[model samples]
Target: RVAHMVVEVPRWTNAKMEISLTEPLNPIKQDVKKGALRFVSNVFPHHGYIWNYGALPQTWEDPRHVDPDTGARGDNDPIDVIEIGERVAARGDVIKVKILGTLALIDEGETDWKLLAID
Candidate 1:
């Protein structure tokens, strides 16, 4: 039960990246081992994303958890987030944000949620 699961999310100490809207869908993820940035891919294009995008720390959508509404598993990754504000965050910038809400998206039989936040 995802709704009943208790996960500690670091609101002030977690690292987040502000993905550019104009840039391709290539996600620039942090290389924790080497302490560097890594370009994953330019797979999808989203024209509706109008804010700084990132993810929450210590929060994972367990792939085994199935949703009752759609009967979909998790995406096996941290919850995606988008920061809405007046400033533009640079790529790979590690910053803090406040979670506002979430949008559940069913992609390929997986429950991929996008968290809404503010800087």
Candidate 2:
């Protein structure tokens, strides 16, 4: 899934949600606006990485101590598109929002995340 892109998450069904990228930066918030976002032939590329670490024994030394090998930080930190929750209701104003989850973006754009709930 793409790392960042404005997607509309459906309530429920079998699938998850749909997303569309806004083109043309907002110039204000320095972010892409929903208008700029498009579901056109233009497709954004996706790239990510995962740093895996091996297991160690008690022999492992803590970084805090004079010893080393504090297990070497192990985490899967990927860089991708994200949605700025701050919805826009104006034309020029730009707001800021935290990035949600990074998606493995499928055929993103003008997609729908069928709803399964009534509420």
Candidate 3:
């Protein structure tokens, strides 16, 4: 299973903003354009995302699958992840990471799971 396999971050992620890639530190309300890394507004103060974020390979969260926790459907995307480490990776650069935990986020009545891992 893709979720059980260990892989690099950037190799599986891309410049497409929403299709795949870590959530931007600053998120614009309706900025849905893909490609290139762009900065929006900061959602937090005194703290920032300290991980090389990406997603799992070959794993899809079917929008039709019902989540037991939220009783909602999946977000129809690969599982999201945040790779915690000291090294900063450029977009499309691959890096090894260890799986840790996960954060569940509900968007527009869908469940999106964010995997937390260490480098």
Candidate 4:
């Protein structure tokens, strides 16, 4: 199946940008931690984001819903996607992607799904 993916963080950049879930119109903004701007750390040999990371629109992982497979509650955010296409997508770019596979990532005891797709 095909679905829309919002490119929040482009590949090779580390600013922790995300779509505002509580703001007006849900604009894309950088995340803040301890009243300061946040950036993701590179895991040694890798630098910045390994792929174009984003989220599936209108698809939220409800915290109240428990995933039977993972036996954990949702992360209360939209489902994240890893676009592995050749081109680097800009922030806020809504592109059509073909659903390839999905990974159940248990983050902080929450079921954070990572959908793998291609443009």
- Candidate closest to the true structure, highest TM-score: 4
In terms of lDDT, model 4 sits at 0.93
Runs with alpha carbons beyond 4 Å of true place in candidate 2? 1-88, 108-119
Report RMSD for candidate 1: 10.8
Model 2 Cα lDDT, one tens digit per residue, 3-113: 212223211111222211233541222223474532223123422111111111112222233212222321211122223332322322222333333222222222111
TM-score of candidate 1 relative to the true fold: 0.56
Highest lDDT model number: 4
Give lDDT per model, in order.
Answer: 0.57, 0.22, 0.58, 0.93
TM-scores, each model vs. reference: 0.56, 0.19, 0.64, 0.92
Report the lDDT tens digits of candidate 4 across residue range 7-72. 999988899899999988999999898899999899778788888999998999989999999999
- The better candidate by lDDT, 2 or 4, is 4
lDDT of 4 at 85: 86
Query: Which tens-of-lDDT digit does each residue in 5-113 have in candidate 3?
Result: 2233332233333333355552212224364354333345422344455566667788888999888899877787777666666554445667778788898889999
Question: Which 10 consecutive positions of candidate 2 have the poorest summed lDDT?
Answer: 49-58
Alpha-carbon deviation at 46 in model 3, angstroms = 6.8
Instruction: Show the lowest summed lDDT stretch of 10 residues, model 4.
Output: 43-52
lDDT per residue as tens, model 1, 1-119: 02111122222223433323334663543334366644334334623234666666556788889977668989787777767655566555556666678788998779989876676
